[model samples]
Target: MADRNPGMDLDLEWVSGVRVNTQAVLKRAQQVQGRKVAKKEWQAAWLLKAATCIDLTTLSGDDTPSNVHRLCMKAMQPIRYDLLQSMGMHDKDITTAAVCVYPSRVADAVKSLKAANSCIPVASVATGFPAGQTPLKTRLEEVRMAVEDGATEIDIVINRTLALTGQWAGLYEEIRQFREACGDAHMKTILAVGELGTFTNVYKASLVSMMAGSDFIKTSTGKESVNATYPVAIVMVRAIRDYYRKTDHKVGFKPAGGIRTAQEALVWLVLMKVELGDQWLTPHLFRLGASSLLGDIERQIYHYVTGRYPAYHELPMA
Candidate 1:
């Protein structure tokens, strides 16, 4: 279904107004010199919460079947097992919810996570992820294959060209088709906000993606020149929150790419907490699409739990 806007003039005016507001926010953010006001409290809370929510690792780039399988096994073993037990809890307590990987390795990830059953979802990046420069049919096929291969969640990239050109209709059509192809699988639409060039575009993309049937709206693919940033995430979350207020349809947010350190992840979590509130903090409403963030959070968790940091080399890599 097409979005219910009163008229073209109103749509254009609304977009233009948002653009003006976006500029003001950006200028204000740039002018601020000192640290963000709630930075400390937000960072501390995120570090603790991130440890429990993170699924620990991601595998990509020249990673073949054997190596990917090996990595999943390692995650299942000493890493997940030890992390859970150390928190004085079971598999249910620790946060790293699911393992994310390339589409080709969906089966391997599913097999590796079988022991946990549905406790952890297998997320696969589809639709020419990172680039998203492909035919709609091809992208839909990718989502279909991933679902067939047992991916519980499909993360597809939005057509950046359409989004940048203001072809909201074309972008919505693509997302609608992808959502249909996904069947029962959850769909996360990556906005690649860095490529969109402005907060207004990011906000519009978020609204359109959700309207088109995205269960979660994501920031980046972690493969672009610009990855996830706090300001960008704040814009997207604000859009989601507003959309929910108007329509009562809740959408989730995932900030992936370049979110490496515990501090960076915490910053995002803090932004979400303040914008979307505590209700959206759970795994269902939030996720960090990170590969190297786990080790950092694990280090923080170790310090908080045991009073000392473990040896750097001793920490496992996902």
Candidate 2:
């Protein structure tokens, strides 16, 4: 995906032409995940790759400084040191792609990572996350503040009202503003796809975000009644592929919220491979926005190597 690059100069015409047949897209989405399984050493390898692409997250109402700090510790080394040693991958750099937190807690995440001497990027959700019902100025400022707080990646929710109402151009300009506000930090535009009304709306929003120069077009904010469904993911990634074909710019894709098992991770890995090709397989261009997903993957890996189930204490804490 790196070779494809992230995005090119905005192309409005290409964005407008992107379309999807709802039934066909949904049919393929059903067929994509879990089509295959990697066992033994291969299973271990897939789990490792999934770990790299995870945006290890903790975006709860109960979030506190200590909770964020502990999450950072996990981000620095998602897999336990002894576990890595057992698989002979101890010396390999094995950390989650990034740590995601709310905008106000960006500084805490940054400080924790720095204190640990880890270069893992802190990603902050901004622009009035879950619902971008605020004014555009306020949302852009949120992105700015997060960037100022040392967030290397900023996940901003798009104005779903614009998308749901068929205001493609409005959505485009707003996301463009969010992208600009991010400056050096990569901007991930969360579509909150489930709220966007239809599959067509989801596809259009994805194109608009990419056209607006989003580094990654995400599926949902995870706060929606629905988030990261297979049909939605397939639609978004296909738009990404179309954008790449027309512009040779490969924007990343992130499916956040509700994905929580090792089998689920493997299914997504398979989806990326089958639909978007192996280039989209790495962390640079693909991310799973999840917290519990990691714990499940870790437990499964531990079982794979040790032939025994890991205890509750063996995993990352609640």
Candidate 3:
């Protein structure tokens, strides 16, 4: 993992004065989408890199131990062995960065990974995940329980009411407490940008999350009406860049939800490489919070190798 972001004091001035030019952000996003994408070998390689950067996730009311075990197995071998060997990448030790599950399932995931003798960190969504509507005490307790259950990474959601009501200091304090609750686990703060109502709010939330020591600032909870979008991502990554400039500290970025295509994954990778440089391209600095994304990426790799797309049942489901 990259150096942990030792949060700094809240800067109300910076938070209040933030502004986003909607037209400019949209134009840049369009330009990024219009750029030529890699083909054949380059495309295959990029898809593999994207697989390694994924936080393979399973967050559902119906999630069971059987499914979680299957998810972990898929994460350990994200792509098919034959496909990797055909591409001369079988021995590269390629695997999803981590496996993310609900707080209750942290122990299950940890046990499965240990049984498999894999060190891929088990990430748990805590603090009333998807909706930070619970009381402060309950939320903090949730974080502690997930950590105690053997979760090495904690993805926490920020209360949208605080951001929407212009309570910058309140938001900072809450995230700081969550950071403390995370203990030794890395904290990935979910801003829920879709509900933040404006791009400026997203930028401020990003800065506040970093200030509160979030190891990674994520875009969505994968349960939002609007998930990761280029315009919103552009703003968040810029905040990361500016924060690094001011504090000489590097924080990570994760764009989650609705990223189901291999091409979309490449676009995010390109955005990171262009905005934050190659350093953020690593799993430590960047993560794609996705579920079905890995399946599509593997399918793309299969097509690249065998000169034909595999049938639906050809590749294992992720």
Candidate 4:
């Protein structure tokens, strides 16, 4: 079973009261930008740390069992053997936090990980991923079905229409049922902030998702035009912080989509480090919803160890 969220019941008063000043939000985003990033051996250490926080993903119309198997293999041994040996981390079992895939591919991921004799978690994106326009019954069934198929974590997208129209109560109740259906599996609420209209909507949705018992509040579905911006993530993490203060439940955070580089990953790790502390830096509490990110992270690590950067093709997906 995954770590329990220990979330409180729907706190309508707190959810409705959530707010964010755009000007202040922009200023804070700017400040985070000005902070120095990890460099030298510290950069390599943070990169390895970032590897553990990655939810190595392969969600595509062309995703095949073969590809998912390859993804699982990558998750089990994210860094190259030579690099791990050189860094003296060969015995450390450095792997990505989790391997995420679609519902139909859940069994494939599980089979691959088990075959590797590894316990890395398999996360399935269900509840009509990237969009939850399916009927309520269908969505709930999706969650249960994914759980039955061996998904240890379920990343479900919020009904974007609800937040766009200011339907906080409806949104909260919907997520509450989804949480129950998850049972022992962790639930990550993807709030596709791009479609939520304003920062205030993003703030309210983040709080409501936490109130409704999301083990983690994710930023986007990764399918949106504008996914996972620094400013938006700051707003969501603040909501997580607020919820933790009120409920003592430490909910996780994931920023999916458009986050594709080592620099970008480090910046996000920096944000979480500054805002929430080291506790949020772990795989159990934070996960980067990414696919190409691992390759870049690998490339950077290779550069650090070999004094030469490998071409993008050197780090193939499969």
Instruction: State the C-alpha lDDT per candidate.
Output: 0.72, 0.87, 0.95, 0.89
Residue-level lDDT of model 2, residues 25-119, one tens digit each, is 87898788538779888999999999999998989999999999999988877887888899999898999999999999999999999988999
Q: Which candidate wins on TM-score?
A: 3
lDDT-best of 1 and 4:
4
Instruction: List runs of model 1 lying over 4 Å from the truth.
Output: 1-17, 27-48, 55-59, 73-87, 90-92, 115-118
Per-model TM-score versus the true fold: 0.85, 0.95, 0.99, 0.97
Off by over 4 Å in 2: 1-18
lDDT of 1 by residue, 1-318 (tens): 112221111133444355427665565434332235334434444565775455444656786777766655545442445644666554544446567788889898787667555346788999988799887788889999999999888889999999889888887778888888988888888998889987889988888887787888889888889987767876888778876776677788888888778767666666666678888887778888777777777676666656787896767655
- TM-score, predicted candidate 3 vs. hidden true structure: 0.99
Q: Write the per-residue lDDT of candidate 4 for residues 55-120, one digit (tens) a residue.
A: 999999999989998899889889888898999999998999999999989999999998889999
Distance from true location, Cα of 261 in model 3, Å: 0.6
What TM-score, to 2 decimals, does candidate 4 have?
A: 0.97
Query: How many clashing residue pairs appear in each of the predictions shown?
Result: 5, 0, 0, 0
For model 4, give the RMSD to the true fold.
1.3
Ten-residue region with minimum lDDT total, candidate 3: 31-40
